[model samples]
Target: MLQLFKKYSVVIRFIAVFLGSYFLLSVLYNAYLIYSENQTEFYPDFFTNIVSRQSAAIMEFLGYSIKLEPHETESAVKVFVEGTFLVRVVEGCNSISVIILFVSFILSFFAKKRATFFYILAGIVFIYTINLIRIALLTIGIYEYPQYSAVMHDIVFPLIIYGTVIILWIFWVRVYSNLEKNESQV
Candidate 1:
């Protein structure tokens, strides 16, 4: 037992610390967001406000007669515009964001100490901004292109977001990992 522990102690310790910390932080943050959103009914209100604002702007620009109203559907009260289009906003777990967070954590684990936190922070900001823009664009796309709406919302948008996350992960591995290599050589 002692010999086995000694052989893999460092690996075990690193895994324990990293995985344990990540799980704790993720769970706590998710719980807080869920609690806060539930308390304030923030999802519906926020979705309504954003879609309405953007939809109104788009309609005004295009000279469309669509007036969006918050209508209660079977499950969610969606913003129904012109009695034809409906926009629903729901905020929940963003798996891609969580994946990005974990990837950033793992990449920065092997990076320079001083640069690691900054790299991870930048990744967080990037992921958050992209996610919001994705949602907004998806809403707009659904409203405008009713025919291609299914493809855009279901297939294309998901690919874009997930692909962005994968690309960012690769960038960190290729470029940032090279930085660590260069530093070691110096």
Candidate 2:
């Protein structure tokens, strides 16, 4: 048992850090959700509201008329393009969860403190921007090609955002993380 543990120490450490951070962050996020639900200031939480508004603004800037309304009975925003109901911007569309996942993975790899902090910050911003673009593009796609809404929303857009995260992860592991140095030393 001890020999096996020693042999897989690095892998175990990565898993531990990843799971630990993910759980802690998720719990905190859930708590925030609960608190936000009780507040009257920002409907559907601040992050989701901001993301929805930003996405709507981006779509409007791209020559599409956009309308945003808080959901009647749900914690979401209804997004319309040219007065046509297109999609709802929910909490899941905000990208906070995705950022949490990305941060957890980066922390698991463990790099230089300053580098890690900046990388995580950059990653969060990139992900948030990508998510906003994703929402706008998805709305446009659905509007232009109503028949392929499922493929655009369920498959293509998700791939784009997640693919970006995966690319970032590869870049971090290859360039920023100390994994290579540690391996070489061994």
Candidate 3:
């Protein structure tokens, strides 16, 4: 048992770190959601509110008239494009959960401290930007082709956003592996 544990220590560590960090971050995020719900300043929650506003801003910048109104009875923001109700921006649309998942996976591989920190920061920013674009494009797609709204919202947009994260993970793993190889050689 001792020998087996030693041999698989790396795997054990990775699993522990990944699960631990994911759980901690998720709990903290849930706490924030509860706190934000209690506060009157932010409708829904801070992150979702910001995401909705930013997405709307992106659409407006592209010359699409956009309007955002807080949902009266639910924790969501109603998004209208060109006076047409396109979609509702909800908590899941904010991308924080996605970022948390990305961070957890990256941290499991544990690389150089500074490199890891910067990579995580850059990854978060990239994910956030991509999410805003995804929302904006999705809204436009729905507005123009309401018949395909289900496919666009349920499949295409999710693939685009999650696909970006997967690509980032692949790149990070490749780079980390190369670094490990070089260090082993040295």
Candidate 4:
């Protein structure tokens, strides 16, 4: 086992360090929030506040009629508009954000050694923005095309969120790795 890792030391080191850092950071932040809540009811309020505010800002910028307001339910933020669908923002969903963080870190590790942490941080923000857009579109889509709920929620919307992450990963690979440029030179 040691011999195998020695042969792939660089690759293993990149994966271990990047993933380890991402997981620890994400888990710590989320745990802090969860533990800070005074009661179980506070979880949804906290989670939805972040998601709804982010989503609403994007929707407002797009000039949409829909608006998000936080409605305190049993322990969650029920996001709704006067004439639109409702969505409950919760903690587990934001795990997607964590996954994105991990992926960005891993990609950055494979990027140029001189790559700045700020660049990787920007990638994380880009991913989060993409996710916000996805949620906003999903809310509108749910209202506009009620019959497409299964496909939209299960397939299409997830593709948008996860696909954006994939695109970022590829972008990092190309820009940092310079694969195309290297191939051309070869």
**TM-scores vs. true structure, each candidate:** 0.64, 0.94, 0.97, 0.73
Ranked by lDDT, top first: 3, 2, 4, 1
Cα lDDT tens digits for candidate 2, 7-116: 99999999999999999999999999998997666778999999988998999999999998888988998988999988999899999999999999999987878888
Candidate 3, residue 148: CA error in Å? 0.6
Query: What is model 1's C-alpha RMSD?
Result: 4.8
Give candidate 1 regions above 4 Å deviation: 1-22, 41-77, 80-85, 93-108
Q: Clash number for model 2?
A: 0
Candidate 1 residue 104 C-alpha distance from true site, Å = 5.1
Residue-level lDDT tens digits of model 4 in 29-135: 76866664765444453554676677877766777655554455544455565455466656545544555464546544554444545556766677677777777
C-alpha root-mean-square deviation, candidate 4: 4.3
lDDT against the true structure, each candidate: 0.59, 0.92, 0.93, 0.65
lDDT tens digits, residue span 69-90, model 1: 4445422335445566556644
Candidate 2 accuracy as lDDT: 0.92
Model 4 poorest ten-residue lDDT run: 39-48
What is the TM-score of candidate 1? 0.64
Error of 1 at 106 (Å): 4.3
Question: What overall lDDT, based on C-alpha atoms, would model 4 receive against the true structure?
Answer: 0.65
Query: How does model 4 score by TM-score?
Result: 0.73
Every model: Cα RMSD to truth: 4.8, 1.9, 0.9, 4.3
Candidate ordering by TM-score (highest first): 3, 2, 4, 1
